[model samples]
Target: MAVEFASPPGNAHEIALTGFQNLARFTQRSHREGEYGMQALPETDVTLSAPRPVHHLGLLQIVAHESIRNSAATGWQYLVLTEDGAVASSELSIGTDERPPVLEQVNMGPFVQSTASALEGLDDIPDVQSGRYELHTLKIPALGAFLLWLRQLDGNADLFIVLSPAPNFLQAGRIYREDELLDALEGPARKRLEFDDSPRGRTEK
Candidate 1:
């Protein structure tokens, strides 16, 4: 597992991270007593979802745990579900006409405060404060479905999480949850997967 980061201007701290997943096969298990120890995988092509079982129990466990953690990320941009089925942080950015690829600029130092200062409706990550603040209740903002959570920036720009599926396998609008990604991996994913391509594929009835 390794961590990678990208920085774009304007935005505060955003992260890019890739860690291990428990996606090994069953044959790669060692048994002792009632518990089992995962065997070393000769290759990294271990599978976690069905149609095939996992070769490494440890990594699969990690992946499952990560799913739970990701399921709990109430706020944070760039929650990436990798093709290989790993969870990582991601960011979105837009550049000026002359700029190459502008990503959010943040500190490269360690031990960043979670409550980093936010820009009213602009920046989402907060600078580390003495305490954590959870929104007990608030307006729905935009009840209409969006590819990702939409944060309006004072009527100027906006920030969104932008991962979507292709249209052939599309369906209706959804509130969207992280677990739905599991469907995209093994079974038939919903139409909301490609909300960007099929904006009205699934609209409120």
Candidate 2:
């Protein structure tokens, strides 16, 4: 069974694509000029999946297990499809009242690779095979955690796949339901919050 992905909101693709095109042009020129350490560009194209909205959570929000739906959309991420698969990713900042969307940066990290791997395995999950999912990126900076948030369109339980460089308590590449993920994050979130609230932490800030 194949996994069904949700369509992005209005004009998101257009906005992201425009940003990507601009980046690609700059990258090409930079590569030719031997600038910014661009050894070579990847020979790949964009995936069929639309840009996924990226959401962020602070320590307080993570500790509270706040619903991501309440979080504002911070940015949009597009996966680059290599011959091997979706191995690279790029991001675009959300448009504001004062400005339009802008290209942020491109990433070819463990999180990107892990997200691609998780998506490849989604077809094996019965629940995912049965329902449509909207892919979203969730980042918890305090925990150094990144997750592929598969929000079930039918209002069922959502799936959160942990990416690499996660906190010790959370296992990378593991697919966790909302409750499970929150439960796993509880201890780590508390520890982090406690540290951040401490005098030493305050002084560092």
Query: What TM-score goes with each of the models?
Result: 0.19, 0.78
Error of 1 at 165 (Å): 6.6
lDDT against true structure, model 2:
0.71
Query: Candidate 1: TM-score?
Result: 0.19
User: Candidate 1 residues 110-142, lDDT tens each?
Assistant: 111111111122233331122232211011111
The lowest-lDDT stretch of 10 consecutive residues in candidate 2 is 39-48
Clashing pairs for predicted structure model 2, backbone only: none
Candidate 2 lDDT over 149-187, as tens digits, reads 888888868888888777788998888998788788778
RMSD of each: 20.0, 4.0
